[model samples]
Target: MTILIIAQLTIQETQRRRILWLGLLMAISFLAVFGIGLHYIVAELDAIDMDRENMEIATGLLLSAGLYVVNFLIIMMTVLTSVTAISGEIDSHTIDTILTKPVRRWEVVLGKWLGFVGLLIVYVALLSGGLMLVFYLRTGFTISNVLAGSSMMILQGLAVLS
Candidate 1:
């Protein structure tokens, strides 16, 4: 219960600070730009009558490259959020308010971790899912093992979130 309360409060704090909004906005814009580029590139390739094997290779490279960028963004976002979690509250004396509650310090930490994990999961789903969706809808193709692939990205983020 204590952990849940702290998690709820941290999520609220994130909203109040507008970090969540900014991240969502950035994700949306990134998706839009990437989708446009991908569509036009695929159309150009089709217009040139690119062979199947070469076209597949080109699209595969493009998708992987985009995913690499997404992974980098995830890692950077994780670092940014972690840097601000406890330390930011301490610097601003907001930790005092949380500590004054009948909450153990460990509970506070765990709660923050819970909140962050939830937030990052949502982020990964939106960005990665949208990327994959665009790739498929634009090209009539699907990546293999999407579940395992996305799980790996979450684990990558968890490494830094820890």
Candidate 2:
């Protein structure tokens, strides 16, 4: 119960700071740039009457590249947003109040961990899902194992978060 409350507070604090909103804006910008680049590439390919096999290969390669970028962005955002989670509190002396409370030391750590994990999961989902959607719409194809691939990205973020 104490952990849950702390986790909830952490989430609210993050939301109040508009970090999530900023992340979304970053995601949208990435999608727009990706879409425009893809549009031009497709237009050029169509103009040259590229063969279906070559188009498929190109599309697959492009999808892989885009997904890689999405994963990288997710990790970067996660780390940047949560880097100061605990240290900043201590630095500001805000942690003194919380530590004086009845909350256990482990509870504080766990709560902060859970809160950031939840935030990162949502972040990864939105950015990765958006990337997949845009890729499908632009190329008229779907990549296999999206969730599996995204899980790897989530794990990557978690590894850094720890």
Candidate 3:
């Protein structure tokens, strides 16, 4: 299918980008630092007055904060990644090869958009899930609301790209 082809190309293109690896490494480092900081903060809160409601609130807040951080990173990466997807190819004369085929210009544009969207979805999903897991392990709390909020960020990113 056209969708699958576009998705595959996008994934391969993204894989070839040095920025992807750099962003990933930075995300991992940031998550580690965030986990350590959250652990200490939660420990301090526990010492103050450990209550179920307070722990829940703390967990939700931590998850929301982690999601926000990851969302920002994803948006930055997505924007940078997409900036050149089409323009770069055209500039390099590679668009001529594709245009010579049966594909229309709009098809190329839509394909690129779909591919980028797919890449963004996978990247954001993994990062968000990892952040959620880390926050859960650190605080023994899971926040569905925070997860929903983070997903909205991905949707927003898609809207911007479209």
Candidate 4:
């Protein structure tokens, strides 16, 4: 119960941060650039009447590159978001207040970590899935290893989070 409460509070605190909003805006802009560039490239390929085989390969390569960028972004975001979670509270003397609560120290630690991890997981899913959907819509192609690739990205983020 205490852990859950702390987790909820952590989520709320992070949600209220200006950094979160800034990060989101940057992400949207990044996706826009990627999407527009890809659309133009695909249009040029269509003008040349590229064969299906080449198109499929090209689409797959694009997905891989896009996901690679997303992977780095997620990793960086996770690091930045978590860097201040504990230290900030300590500096602000907020840790004193939380320590006086009924919750154990470990509970506080675990709750904050879990809360951030949950948030990052949702973020990764939405960005990756949205990009993949855009790719599919723009070109009737799908990466053969999309599921596996996404899972790996998530794992990589978690690894860095720890």
Candidate 5:
């Protein structure tokens, strides 16, 4: 019961932050631009006459670079979000109100962590879906392995946070 209440409040508080919305919008815009750029770059590369092995190697490198960019962006966003979450409340003295409640401190910590985890999960899912769509449209192939690998990276992030 306490965990639920804390989780709900944490989520509500996170939702109330204007920075969160801004970050989300910025991420979406970034993804779109990156996708278009990648599509054009790949198309240009494909136009060059190279041996099958060379072409495959070049394509793999290009896709790997794209995946690296996506990974970096997602990690940066997650770190920004998580680092700010509780510190923001404390800075504003908003945590005092919660501290005065019957809840334990550990509950507050855990709940906030869980709330941030939920937020990160949603962000990652949307970004991954966007990347998959872009890759499919541009190359006629879906990088399931890249998606899975990114998912592991996200989970590793969550583990580190906990």
Candidate 6:
């Protein structure tokens, strides 16, 4: 219960700082750009009478590239948010207040870490799923093994985060 309270507070603090909001705003815009670009690319591909085989190749490359970019952003954001949450509190002397409480230091740290981990998971799901959905809607091509791909990406993120 204490850990959960701390975790909730940590999330609220980041929201109060506008970190999560800004990250989400940026991600939405990124998806919008990808969607627009995909629209144009698909139109051109159809206009050129591209065969299904070549079309699949083109779409596959685009999805792979987009997925890679999302993965990279996830790793970067995890690092950035982690640094800001930890060192920012320290520099602002907010950590002093947290430590003055009844909670253990490890509980404080773990709670904050859990809050960020939750954010990362949501971020990955939204961005990767959004990108793939855009790709499919624009091209009529579904990604093969989405479950496997997303799981791998999540694992990669966890590895980088730790």
Taking all chains together, the TM-score of candidate 4 against the true structure is 0.95
Q: Cα miss at 93, model 1 (Å)?
A: 2.2
Cα-lDDT of candidate 2: 0.87
Give the residue spans of candidate 4 off by over 4 A. none
Give the candidates in order of TM-score, highest first. Answer: 4, 2, 1, 6, 3, 5
**Deviation in angstroms for 145 in model 4?**
3.4
**Over 4 Å off, model 5:** 49-56
Colliding pairs, model 5: none
TM-scores, each model vs. reference: 0.92, 0.93, 0.89, 0.95, 0.81, 0.89
- Candidate 6, residue 11: the lDDT equals 73
**Model 5 RMSD, rounded to 1 decimal:** 2.5
Backbone clash total for model 1 is 0
Tens digits of per-residue lDDT for model 5, 1-162: 787677777678777877678778877887788778877777777778566577556656766776676666677767766777677889999889989988889998988888778777777777766776776677665455766776786886686556
lDDT of each: 0.85, 0.87, 0.81, 0.85, 0.74, 0.82
Per-residue lDDT of candidate 3, residues 1-162 (tens digit):
665676678778888999888878878887888888888988898899879897888767776777778878888878888898888988999889988987777878888888888878877877887787788797777665766665797898897787
Which pairs of residues clash in candidate 4, taking residues 3 or more apart in a chain or in different chains?
none
For candidate 5, give the lDDT of residue 129. Answer: 69
lDDT of 1 by residue, 45-158 (tens): 999999988988899999998888788777876777666989988999999997997889999999999888877788889889999998999987778988787888899999
Where in model 1 is the C-alpha error above 4 Å?
Answer: none
lDDT of 2 by residue, 1-162 (tens): 999888889888888776677887888999899988888898888899999889879978887888888888888878877888899999999999999998888999999989988998998898889888887898787778989998999999999989
- Residue 104 displacement (Å), model 1: 0.8
